[model samples]
Target chain A: MNQIAETLASEHIHRDEVGAKIGMWLFLFTELILFGGMFLAYAVYRFSYRDYFALASKELDVFIGLINTLILLTSSLTMAMSITALRRGNKKLSLIFLSSTIIFALLFLVNKYFEWSAKFNHGLFPGSNDLLSLPRGEIIYFGLYYVMTGLHAVHVIIGMIILLFMLFYIKSNKVNQDYYIMLENSGLYWHLVDIIWIFLFPLFYLIH
Target chain B: MEHKNNHIVGYGTYIFVWLTLVTLTALTVTVASFDLGGFSIVVALIIASVKALLVMLIFMHLKFDDKIFRIFVAVAFLTLMIFIVLTFSDYSFIR
Candidate 1:
């Protein structure tokens, strides 16, 4: 009976290690398609309205976008390191790195808030008269801008929530050196979000 | 049972990749400031693709993970490319 019980437990853990990761990757692909659809829309519109897209893109503040990009890239670094720290059995350092990642994520969101607020104050949002009065291309530009970045921001929030749960799991020793698929999966999600911003920063902010 | 997190990356590697990514970000920003016209978007996208590759391989550990993950990523991007191409082919003939 003891032999059978041990076999079952070990087999369960073994299956979970790879199976969980595979499952996470599959989910990430679906997310890619979701964002890819938006990207497709942006592409078609931009191709049709090249000059207007360039003109409208200038309204975005490059400095803010640059800072947010750096923050997200650094957050991704810290997230990757956190998993490494955990795998090395240094729980405290891992926790610190993970916490820093969360902090950076919040900072990115704060920057985004100010940036969007400035646009809103200018009445540049969708359905605003100011936006309506703009050229047709610029109108579509701002529309894609809000939808894409807003969706990315929502993803940032989701990544934070996932990492926060990872913190609790690590603290409880539920996700330790031997079993940390949850932490790794959360890191994957965070990196995916970072990757999305990587494309977004160029398409929206740098095109000007 | 052997753990999946067996291939451990050091702090140095992550830091190195981070520095490269930052430098590339700076490079992309600088490149965009110069009005290279059509080449500007091309250059910016190339740089962005490189950065994304680094993040996926190193930070995301697709480098060390199972082959299936990489295959799935490749397939996903390929599918996205197909959609983009098909849409453009249709749109290009519109006018």
Candidate 2:
């Protein structure tokens, strides 16, 4: 009876690889749509108050945004390479690449911390006197900047955590060459993070 | 549903994509510094879209993924574009 019960459970478990990926992609689509709505809101606000938005954009440090973009791009490369390493059956190399990816992610968040701190030093927080005293359009611009980038940063953190779990899975031999969809999915999510930043950086920092 | 089809991308390919992405980033930064007026935003967005495409195709392996997966991604982007277009159309007439 116990053997029969185990067989029945295994039969229904059906761990379809492509199906799992399709599900992840569908979830990612929802994420894209969520960010798309925010971007549309940004578009309307910038269109309505062009000059003020431009003025507000100037307050951002292009250098920080540039550095963060490079970091994320590098991280994305490392992430892709990690999967390649795993497929090649080089567990050590894969782990190294994954570690580098996570480090780059941390570096990005560190830069974000300093950037936000500088804004706070100048009293540019959400409800600070500096931000509140600005023109309505400028206020909206900063508001969107904080919310959008903040959300993206949250995603970076989440992606890093996922990579950490993947590392453990690799260490346990659970994500080897023959079965590595977990690692691949994590890489997919990291690339999504990179893609979003590719758009976010220019929209917020380089909108001349 | 081809779960066994795996394409191992080369290190050189990733490096090349990185180079292109870096170059595009530099271009966006340099172009933004100039006084291009309305064209600046459009140029930046176009460059961004290209960078995004490279990442999606290579890093995400969309080029090698299953056909149905690619179809789903295409549908998602199409839906997003329609939403953006509709929003702009409304704003163009209303404002």
Candidate 3:
């Protein structure tokens, strides 16, 4: 009787593990579609006013963009390391790496704030501003600019919140070598966010 | 617990991925600075694709996962690209 009960409990845990993995993948698919729409809009506007887009992109601070790119890329490295730690049964190192990933993500956001505010102060916002004094085409370019990067920033915020939750989960012992799906899934989402910025950096800040 | 497979990610792999990403970023920025005419976007997108592969494979561990999951990811991405391209064609060629 005792052996049967133990077997039943183990089976239940295995079922939950599978469920978590599938659930996370489904959530990731939703994110893919969400970002997919924004990419489509960016492509349309960029193609419509290619020259104006190039001119507007030059106004962006490439230095800040480059810095943010490096920051996010570093965060991704830490995130991957965190997952590796979890899989290897090193809970303390996993938590440390996870904390660093969150810190780097926050740094990325702070840099973005300054970059966006600088543009705002310069009157580069949509719907008529001093920065739009160039031409009508450039004005429309700034509009798309705010919309795309603004949306990307929002995603970064969401990713940060998710990472925070995962961190707490680790601390609470909900995640360990036996079960690290949360870390894996969050890592995937974080990587996607980084990949988006990989494209955004050049699109918004590198045109000559 | 049944350990079906154990695939560890080494530190060298991490460094290699990061190097590839930085190199690609530099290339993209340099290409964008030149007057490549219509080829600029093409080159940018190609570089972005390579970066995406590195992240998906190395960071996300898709390379070590089940084949089914990989197939699903590939199909999803291909479908998304096709949809975007078809929609863009409508706007690009229209009067």
| Winner by DockQ | 2
Interface RMSD of 2: 0.9
lDDT of 2 by residue, A1-208 (tens): 6467547746786667887788889889999999999999999998998899888898899999999999999999999999999999899999999999999999999999999999999999999988999999999999999999999999999999999999999999888876788998888899999999999999999865
Query: Which regions of candidate 2 fall more than 4 Å away from where they truly are?
Result: A1-13
TM-scores (chain A) of the candidates = 0.94, 0.93, 0.88
lDDT of 2 by residue, B1-95 (tens): 24666688999999999999999999999999998999899999999999999999999998888788779989999999999999998889993
Residues A47-135 of candidate 1 have per-residue lDDT tens digits of 88999999999999999999999999999999999999998989999999999999999999999999999999999988999999999
Evaluate all candidate structures by whole-model CA lDDT and list the values in order.
0.92, 0.92, 0.81
Q: How would the docking of model 2 be graded?
A: high
TM-score of each candidate? 0.95, 0.95, 0.90
Q: Write the residue-wise lDDT of candidate 3 on B1-95 in tens digits.
A: 44333677976798789888888888887787788888877888888889988998888877877666688788878878898989977887887
Instruction: For model 3, report the TM-score of its A chain.
Output: 0.88
lDDT (Cα, tens digit) per residue for candidate 3, span A58-159: 788888888898898889999999988888878899999999999998999999899878887877676554855677667777776787778788988999
Any runs in candidate 3 off by more than 4 Å, and if so which? A1-19, A131-134, B1-5
Q: Looking at candidate 3, what is the lDDT of residue A178? A: 59
Worst 10 residues of 3 chain A by lDDT: A13-22
RMSD of each: 2.7, 3.8, 3.1
Error of 2 at A56 (Å): 0.8
DockQ values per model:
0.81, 0.86, 0.58
